[model samples]
Target: MGHDQVVTSKGNDHPGNGPAVSREEFDALFEALRTWGRWTPADRGACNRVSPEHVRRAADLVRSGTVVPLARPWDTEPGPDNARPALHYMSELGDAEAPEPSVHKDFLGADYHGKAVSHLDALSHIAYRGRLYDGRTAREAVGSRGARFGAVSALGPLVTRGVLLDLPAVSGEKWLEPGRAVHAPDLVAAEEALGVTFGEGDAVLLRTGRLRRRRERGAWDLDAASAGLHVHAMPLLAERGICVLGGDGDSDVRPSPVDGVRSPVHTLALAAMGVPLLDNLALEALSAACAEAGRYAFLLVVAPLNVPGGTGSPVTPVAVL
Candidate 1:
C-alpha cells in the first residue's frame, strides 16, 4: 500500500511533515515498538523504545508533583477489543496440586512479562501497508525463540509536558455517555476553562468520562467506551506538535461517522505521523490533583512492558504538578 493518508471527521488531512521521525524521537519510540510489535513473531530489529532525554523530562515532572500511578492491575482474563463495559479474563492461583514450587510463573503462563497495567504502545503496535514501521515485515521479525526488541527492552520511559482536556467538566455533563465522542470544540472548551495552551512535545490526556459511567453497567457494547481525537481533534493536535496522546477512553473510535473510516486517528497519528496513543489510563486521581493545584501542564512519565513483539501493552502515565 502506498503511504496511507489519514483524515479526521471534520475533513482535515494529517500527513506528517516527512519520513524523518528524528533520531532523538526514534530513540525513544523504537524501544517501545519492539516490545509491543505484533510482527515480532517474524524478525527482530534493533531499536530503542525510549531515550535518556525523555527520562530526564519525566524526572523533572515528578519533582513538581507526586507520581500518580496510571494502570489498573491486570486480571486473569483480558477483555475484548471493542469499548466494552466490563473486562473479563482468566486467572491462575497457586494451588498445591497445580504446579511444583520449582516452576517459575511466567506472566500468567504466557511468555510475556511485566505488570499488565503498565505499558507503552510501541510504533510496532500498529503498522501500515505490508510492513511495520520503517518497512520491516513480521515474517522477517518473528522467529522460533519468539519476538524481541533487539536490545535490553523495546521502549524506554517517556517524559514531557502533559495537559488534560476534561470533556465531562467542559460539556457540563455529569459524564460522557458511552459511545459518545468528545470533539475538537469540546477540547477547546476544556483548554479555555483550564487556561492552558497546547505546545510542542506535549503529552495530552483527555477524559471522556465514559469509563466511570459505563463500567458500572456490567457489560459494555460498541458504545461502551468513549471516542477520541477522530476528525474532531487530530488536526488541532498535530498542528500544535503534540508528540503523544493519552485518554481514559480507547484511543480508536469504532463505527466512525465516516462510512469507510475505522478509527482513522489510529492510522493518522501513529502510522502517518509517528504520534503515540496512551489509553485506558486511570486519571481520576491525577485529574483531581491538577484541580487542586489549579494547573494542568506538568511533567508526564510513561513506561511500557519490554515484551518483544506484543500488541498494545497496558500503560501507567502520571502528571506531576
Candidate 2:
C-alpha cells in the first residue's frame, strides 16, 4: 500500500501476477460462469437484466448532478501502448470558400480494439474456442463482412448504477503498479471498505489508478504486464449478477496466469457470461469525484456508436453524481 509496497508474484517472467493457472482450471471457471440459453434476444445477454425500475433507481442517485467523463482523450500520438495511433487530419481547411462562410472539417478514425482508446467491447468482439456468446459459431457469425450475431448495434444506450472499486485509495497508495492481480477476495474487501454493494444490473468499474500511474511513470507494454482481475474473480461477479464490467485495463492480468489463455477475463465475461466490457477508461477523475461525494455509486451511461455488424465502438462513457 505504501510507495515502496508493490504487488509482485513469482512466475517465469510475470513480475506482478499470481501463481500460474493451467488451461484446465481456466476452462472450469468458464463453464461455471457460462449462462447460455438463459435470456431472450441472446445478443442482449446480461443487459436484459436491467429493467425500467433499475434505470429509475439509478437516475435517483444523481443528487449533485456532477458528470464525470470516463474516457481517455483521442490518442493521436504514438506510444509504447498505442501501437496504432488514431488518425485525425483536417479534411477541408477554412481557406478557399465560395461565400463569406468558410468551414473546417476533420476526420477521425481508429482500430479501437486495442489498449490506447476508450472502447466498449460487445459480445461479438471476443470468441473463446470457436464460438461466440450463446453458442453462436464464430466463423459463421463473424465473417469478413462483420459480425451478424452480437454486433455493437444490438446494444443500445446503457444506463445503470455504477460501482467504483478504488483499489489504490483503499490501499493508501497513489496507484496500483502494473501486474497487480485483483482477485475475488479483493472485490469483497473493496465492497466493505468503500461502503458500496454490487447489485444486479449494475456496472462495476475497477479503478486501479492506471492513468495516474501512466502519467507519473511513462507508458509500458500492457501485453507484458498490467493490473487487472484474475480468472478466479469471475465467479463472484457472476454471482453478483453484474450487467457490465469495465476498468482502466482490458480486465486481464497480463503475461496471463492461465497458460495458453491470452485474455481469460475476456473469455469469461464476454464468451461465457455475455457481459460487455468498457476498456481503457480514464477513471482518475471519477475516483476523486466519488471520494469527494462520499459515495462510490452513481448513474453511469454508455452510448456506443451504432455501427451495424460492428464488433465494438470507440466510446466516452459518463458517470453522474
Candidate 3:
C-alpha cells in the first residue's frame, strides 16, 4: 500500500485512558495491513523486502566499523515478566578421564518465548482469530510438530539498515514512564530530532531507556505496564515498509491500549502485515553509540538459529557503525 493509503487512528477513543481501538476497528486495521498472497507462498514474510540492493545500501552505513551487541544477557532468574528462567550449567569441567584434549562443556536452554530471553519471533509465532498469516488455520499450520509456515528456518541471516528511534534521547527523559504510549507523532518528532529517517526494508528499533529504568529503580511487572509503540503507530511503520520491528520491550505497550487485544502491535505486525519481530533486545549500548556518533542509522545483522519448524529462536543481533 502507498503512504497515502495509510490508515490513521483519529476518532476511536476507548472507554479508559487508552487508545480507542474497538474490536471492529482492530479487525479493519488487520484487513488493511494484511499481505496475504502478496509474495510467493513462503514463510519468510516481509523479509522479502530486503533485496540485494537493500543489503548493499546497509553495508554503506558501516563507516567507523564499531560493533555493538544488542541482545540482553540470558537471564536465569525469574521476575514478574519472566515467568520462565533460562538454564545454564557445565556439562563437563575438565573432569573427564585422561584424554588428548581437555574441554569444558556447558549446556544452555530456555523457554525463550518469554520476557527474559532475547529472541526473534517468526511470522508464525502469533495467531489471530484461529488463523496464522496468509489465512492459514492455526490448527492446521501449528501442531505439536511445530509451525508449518513462517518458521525461523525460513528466515535466515537478516542484513539491513537499522534505524534506532531513541525516544528518551529525543524527549530528554531518563526513561519514558511505564504505561506510556509512543504514538505516530512521537515517531515523527523523534526522527526530526535525531535527523534520521526510516524507509523501505529497514529494521526499526525503538528504545525507551528500559534498561536504564531497570538499573535505577529495579525490575517491575513489565507485563503489567511498559513503554512501547501503540497500535496507532502501525500505519506509520507500514507506510515506511519496515520489514523488522523491535524494542527493549516486546514492542507492545502493556495494559494494551487496544480494547480486548493483549498485543495489538504484535498482531498487526506479524499476523497481519507479515512482518517479523525482534523481542527483548538490549538497546542501551546502541543508544550510547548513537549519541557518540551523532548518527542513529547503522548496518544491522541478525542470525537466528536454523531450527526448522521452530516458532522462534534466541538471537544476538549486532549493529555496525
- Judging by lDDT against the true structure, name the best candidate: 2
- Candidate 3 has which clashing residue pairs, if any? 13-20, 14-20
Instruction: Write model 2 residue lDDT over 1-321, tens digit each, in one string.
Output: 212223444452566577788989888888889999999889988999899999999999999999999999999988778999999999989897568688999999999999899999999999999999999999999999999999999998999999999999899999777888899999999999999999899999999987888887778877767899988888999999999999999988886888888898998999999999999999999999999999999999999999999999999999999
For candidate 3, what is the lDDT?
0.87
Ranking by lDDT: 2, 3, 1
TM-score: which candidate is best? 2
* Residue 287, candidate 2: C-alpha displacement in angstroms: 0.6
Q: How accurate locally, in lDDT, is each candidate?
A: 0.53, 0.90, 0.87
Model 2: weakest 10-residue lDDT segment is 1-10
Residue-level lDDT tens digits of model 1 in 1-321: 121122222222222111223334433433433323433322222112224674466456554446667665454444332322224434444554754663333333321222123345555555544345544564564356443422113545566678888767666775655445455666777899988877666778887664555444432443223355544456677667676776776565543433344455565565545566776677777767777777777777676656555554555676667
Q: Is candidate 1 or candidate 2 better by TM-score?
A: 2
- Predict model 1's lDDT versus the native: 0.53
Off by over 4 Å in 1: 1-64, 77-119, 135-152, 222-225
**On a 0 to 1 TM-score scale, where does candidate 2 land against the true structure?**
0.96
